[model samples]
Target: MEWGPTGAAAVPADYAVVVDVLSFTTTLSVALERGIEVFPFRWRDARAAEHAMRHGATLAVGRFEAMSRGDARHVSLSPASLSEVEGIQRLVLPSPNGSTIAFALADSGAQVVGACLRNAGAVARWLAPRVADGASVVVVPAGERWHDDTLRPAVEDLWGAGAVLDALLDALGGEDEVTSPEARMAVAAWRAARLPDDLLRCAGGVELTDVGFVADVEIAAQHDVSEVVPVLVGESFRDATEVQPAAPKLRRVDG
Candidate 1:
């Protein structure tokens, strides 16, 4: 299934991929690759700190705050910032769209993973074996916010989700076994929008560039550059590669 941030509750798949290309999931992919456990939060608030403490995680500050430090050790939502840092045991990553959608999905009992253009192929390959034959895999794009606080579907996110969908479909052989129309369209859109150059010209990319986050946009646009698949487990995201394989479910004997 494919939907914007607002349709998070509508996801019905047991395995889910959340794509937020502008920053959230992209930063998360970078952070996870560095061995830091990321705890997603819906907002940067008092509750965010509380949630972080409960999970033994440190609350990430705003980008400005993170950038001001001489050593730049803080973890913020910026993918560029997270890419250079290391040795953080836990971090609370807050985002209005991506983290909110992730929080919602966590409550719905799906095994959630963050995906971006950087790691779509790796995530697809990682998830393919876990998906039961014929089971659905939902892809939720964390779009930007409109003036009225509604979801404004973002081109970058669409491409990011598409990259993951395209890889997963290829992994599964074809879309013949899948059911979502949005998923098909997402893959087509991704195919139409080539990486790097196309992404740099997109609306989201333009916005980021204007705001002086050109590096973040550049980093987010890199396709299949990362192999780390960040899976949400318990209260934080750990490297899916390090997670122990799930034990097979045993059938109960009939009385």
Candidate 2:
């Protein structure tokens, strides 16, 4: 399912996968790689400094729309400082769109994994065993809602999610087969034929380049950099490298 910033409501599912391809999700992945613990906050209700004070969590805010708000005590995930907080706890996060969606799916029954173009390949390998067991996988792309009708970058998440779906299919040895309607659409949108270029042209990719995080963008665009798959454990996420089969496929009606 694709959810916008304001639509951070919890949904029922076996697993909720969040993707904020452009920077937020990519930032989260980078932070975790650096050893920083990332805590998600709802965009509408998120007051980073206040929340940090209340929960004693460190604040890590991103600069967006050319504005920098909140306390200076927090760390900013600008392209320049992406590698600084490798192993710290990032209490409050205000990302362009990805962070909020991660929070929205926090309560989803299935495990939550932060996704970006960078980790798509690793994520697919991580989920290969699960899909083989018939687990219901829901890929949630934390997309944008553009006010201007002329250009909307939110659809980039859809393309990112499609790339993930394609990766999963390939892992399952069904690269040439359409597993479902959503899979087919994602494949079509990405033109799954020329995946690498398609991924580079995504909205998130453009934003990363503008911010001079093109290297970071390229890193996130890689299939699987680490075998470590980040999964939410209690309040924070830990690296999960083992892939377990799903409990059992549940038959449900999607009306």
Candidate 3:
């Protein structure tokens, strides 16, 4: 288990579980469940609009920004906001944490899997077979950014990463696979977490709720409620399980 891009760069495993619980990965899971192919982009990238237009995909903005726009168009980093979105075949979802790490990992030849509290178990289930076959895996907790553009190490992401690690360990129980101390620490954090209640009080959760996105916080706390395992394929994330048995498996900003 590691935090942010720097840590991610230091550990390039065969499989990477990208976690950004308050947004990104969680939102990706929700969109995947709706059949919307998601393209991860850098947060606040001015080129995102151009990329979206070029590919005829919707570009997501911040939750508060979208809400203040007073338009009916739905979609944002907030998972709950996408609940009512429809007819969007594709989306250009941007984020500084999860999306950045995902694209970086993809370029490094690592199989990228988007994981959040919502779909941790599903991701673990998807990874079990491959891991048992001796594949390496790393759970990356994409921490929040500070005002100075530094890593904030949000507890929300830690919990999300922990959730995935714990599930993976459970799925691989009794295996003598070498698990790192950091991975063990994350699993311990998950074991000690108090669920929705604790999540609600965490810094990340408070930040979202204070901005009137309490629903998003509540949605993120719904652990393992999703079965969609988002696998980054080509320039988008699609459900590998939904792919035909014969088809190739499962992200640049390009279409």
RMSD of each predicted structure:
3.8, 4.8, 5.0
In the range 72-190, model 3's lDDT, one tens digit per residue, is: 46578888878778778899998998998887787777788899999999999988888877678879999999999999998888888888878888898833548788888887888
Q: Where does candidate 1 stray beyond 4 Å? A: 245-255
Most lDDT-accurate candidate: 3
RMSD (CA, Å), candidate 3 to true, equals 5.0
Query: Which residue pairs show collisions in model 2?
Result: 14-110, 15-110, 34-86, 34-87, 35-86, 35-87, 36-88, 117-220, 118-220, 118-221
Question: For residues 178-255, what per-residue lDDT tens digits would candidate 2 score against the true structure?
Answer: 255765676576544344554566665676678665665565555455454567655555556433433433434353
Backbone clashes, each candidate = 0, 10, 0
Q: Model 3 misses residue 94 by how many Å?
A: 0.5
Query: What are the TM-scores, per candidate, against the unseen true structure?
Result: 0.91, 0.73, 0.92
Q: Is candidate 1 or 2 superior in lDDT?
A: 1
- Greater TM-score among 2 and 3 belongs to 3
lDDT order, best first, reads: 3, 1, 2
- lDDT measured at residue 183 in model 3 versus the true structure, 0 to 100: 84
The weakest ten consecutive residues by lDDT in model 2 span 65-74
lDDT (C-alpha, whole model) for all candidates = 0.82, 0.60, 0.85
> Model 2 segments beyond 4 Å from truth?
1-12, 44-46, 64-74, 148-155, 175-178, 191-216, 241-255
Clashing pairs in 3: none
